[model samples]
Target: MSSRERVLAAVAGVAGIAAAATLATPGAAASGRYQHWDDTAYRGQIEVVRSADGPSDPTVLNGTVFVDRDRDSRHDRNERGLAGVEVSNGREVATTDSRGRYRLPVYDNMTVFVTQPAGYQVPVDEFNVAQFHYNHLPAGSPDLRYGGIAPTGPIPDAVNFPLVESRLTDDRRLSCIIAGDLQTYDLDEVEYARKGAIADLARRNDYQGCGSLFVGDVVGDDLSLYDEVKGLTAQTNGPARFLPGNHDLDFDATTAEHSFDTFRAQLAPAYFSYDVGNAHIIALNTVRYPCTPELDNADGLRPECDDPVNRPRYNGAIDATQLEWLRRDLAKVDRDKLIVIAGHIGLLNWADEGSAIHQVDQVREVYSLLHGRKAVALAGHSHSIENLRTGDSMQGWRDLFGVQSLPFPHLTVGAIAGDWYSGQVTEAGYPTALQRDGGRPGVLTLDLHDSSFQERFTVTGESDRVQTQLGLNSPTYREWYVARSAWNRNPVGAAPELGDPLVVDQADLAGGTWLTTNVFMGATGSTVTVRLDDGRPRAAVRTQAMQGEDQLVGPEWSDPVAVAEQLVHGGSVADRTMHLWRFALPADLSPGTHRAHVTATDIHGRRFTDSLTFRVVASR
Candidate 1:
């Protein structure tokens, strides 16, 4: 459908609307994020008019947006209500009153939340999970394997949200963290999280503005690990938020409505938006649960299990309801501001580039709505680090999402629990968890300047300076790859086929050897140039041109350096990607120690230079 048709559909969604109370956030500054106000109120206290009485009354979903003067997290007798704070029910948007109060018509499973204003910080529990929402599910969820929302009986006299005054997020300059999956299946993996990325975040105070938005797959299939995930978040220096992933769902739930109840009860809303400075961040529930009757096999992509009547399959598309809700939400955002759209499943991807079910079906619709606006999308679920700039394209995106090319920057943030915490356990106690494309496990940050920004990736337990991974892709390495693939299919030795990785012989150079670098945030307009031993500079070629070619995969396309670590230590092989670049070496150069001074420049013109030295032997 055209963008116009989608808007008309959204307008049609506002149907069945009944007369309601005034909606407004009183006595607040008007500009940017929230301007117009609507009033809300309910009875002294709301009773869960029995499930038999039908869906909870829409108008009685009420709450307060107050100043927690003591930071006690509850409305105290002397605490004054802050006016003009916007509150929303995903569909119907409202604002607080002069008394810092709000009310909106709500149903059985609606999320009533406050879009935290700019100057004040929302209250975070010990785990740094922001307390900005109140879920209303009067009768609770039906019986399911993962326990969902317990009946949140009658509405309390007040569902109060506390905001503390802060100077950190008051302006246009902001640092928003877009972290990929931390798919920890057990407590041990949680420890890896603690020692790796969480520890790194604890050392910095910069991201307190937009905080950390863990894209998804927060945990493996086990919902029991939610608290441990919370424990990891508590270690961060700023507030943390989460969106649900395919693994984070209750697969046993009979219907879609209760799919993420437990997650909603423990984390932030399944989908929500907030603003800081000029950046408007929207977190979405991109994963659809029970995607297949069973699991993915080696033969093909996971089957669509979403047989609503039988075995349900998870999918990578947004439903009509969410599309309508997104339409309504974006309607409130300004045209010129930065819109950071985040989801678990990427809108389009290079990893799983062959699977149509791994990307969103509504990618085109979303692009249509966000066309005129300054936008960037961040996602997880595909464990690779991808920075797709405007005009970046791949066969899968065009074939699956129907998107010919990226309209704006679309990034696939690297995972925190890299490759499912695979590889060797470090002395630091974390696994190398090298991703499928060989990118290191790390997090991404968007340094916002008004509506535009520069993207940077920081390897965990390392500095921002550690931006690229250098490796050798030679005939020798390719031979080892063939052997390794065979051995992986059928074991041959204790150690894999990877030989001494850093060394290259005359034969290896004679056959052809290329120095490869995987720049984590490299994208279109980026340049990778090399100068050997102070020789003339030469530009390297990016493997995946992203101009509508099929994805290049397997050992032939793998990064030798990351492969060396992953193959021997046990993690994913970084064998394929769009950002890995290679520079051919001169075969006749004299046998001696040589250094390749490599310079990589990102789309933003940020240059990161690093040198790799290799000893060329006459014969080894």
Candidate 2:
């Protein structure tokens, strides 16, 4: 039964069939922290009145109002004064006086929500914080299917807003499910990340349009499982965005700006930026534990060589005021449009084997401040699965800023705990063989479509199957199986066979490790070799260039079955988790059913081939 007794019997069968009045209390869990609120604990005063029967009259919409008594949209101080609570503006609805104040009636693309009241719970921001709906339109909204509130026509007298009661929103483009480190600090690795990747994002529907971005450690040091990671982002399918890793900070805070003050007060934007659609999405914090007093070694002194909490430091660096607010948010974007840049480390890598601080020093000054149009950078502290591409490496920053390489794409996106969530647990309840570079435990589905962008690697409950590439072992079978993989400790069972239907007699591929793939936008020269259907004559093995920690030079090792069939034809793992790759057939080949052809070449080079048939047999 263990996996922490099936996650404590699935949190005691979800608190004995859900609704313990919708659990939260404890002063709304100390007002959930509003992504770290400090706009000066907000005073109160609201009044956007105008419902005398339409055509404007009860006009009185001033502004600044936030208390949300634990409604969960984020605004604290033990969230009190809900007096009459009831706010709206999509048309009209008001209440909240006797100090809890309210007077609603305004519109310019209105959306002033607050209808959360069961056993009370609203307020979030240090990452546990939620509540955001006040778009104020000027001239947008008509793309339907959940893109709402853009049209800027009328309805505005005194449009004021300061709410604390929330369910989370901002006119909606939302479904942000990014997922990286579910680190898990026990409870059988949080039921092996809840039956391998939150039970497939809780029985999916294509992320329902913007809600999921685990992007950090989430627990691992056990901050009391932040309420069991908000009950696993409320069993997902939407709404859950958190960022902060170096193991989700708080090495007992005390300073270092209080190390994410308990996660900015529960998560909203330690660095922040959002747009969706034509895409913009930035989210950085980069782990900066400053701590002075000559770097307090708890007073024993002698620390400070740029104190990141007296150093154990993870790689990648950013601060300088978030690189000057990412150089004025990439100068208000539009270098033809398409920037993504998420974080947790990773700007360019052969998976940190070259470790210039685990990647991201100047990154060519941020790829010359992203001057060469079309971008897509994501990270997840190497839990593994690289994707790489574009001249395959000079170590990112688009080749340290002289630019060139990306004519238009970049990625790293892999880890829903594929490795940290480890292995062993099959009956399809999940978790079996996820060492990463080989793929599995997924999420990464970009699709921009205007300034051009495409990426897919969705695997968790086999949502159709998109995995780009990963197939290891070469280097003359690592010097003919490094001492029988240290006497069968299993270096992927010491492979090397190229005989029988597996004939590749002499391309002598020297000492190998990395072999990745995923190419679509127009592909190129794509000749991903390795074909053996007998007829005996194998030859494409050269060396020098791809180095170690399990080699495979970049662009996600050039082609792992064409990036796992473009992440299973781009449904992005239909929901999340499950994508595998593990090549090891060289023990001197001579068994049965062989065939493993994978070819691709486009950008007018045009060529395609896909085949997979296995059955080595004959061991005893």
Which segments of model 1 are wrong by more than 4 Å?
1-59, 70-84, 97-101, 291-303, 306-311, 493-496
Tens-place lDDT per residue, model 2, 423-449, is: 445565545335334455666655444
List model 1 lDDT by residue over 535-557, tens digit each: 98899988888888888887657
RMSD of each: 12.7, 21.5
Error of 2 at 46 (Å): 13
**Model 2 bad stretches (over 4 Å):** 1-62, 70-130, 142-196, 200-234, 237-239, 242-400, 403-437, 443-620
TM-score against truth, every candidate: 0.86, 0.32
Relative to the true structure, how large is the alpha-carbon lDDT of every model? 0.75, 0.46
The Cα error of candidate 1 at residue 327, in Å, is 1.5
10 residues in a row with least lDDT, candidate 1: 37-46
| Top candidate (lDDT) | 1
Output the TM-score of candidate 1. Answer: 0.86
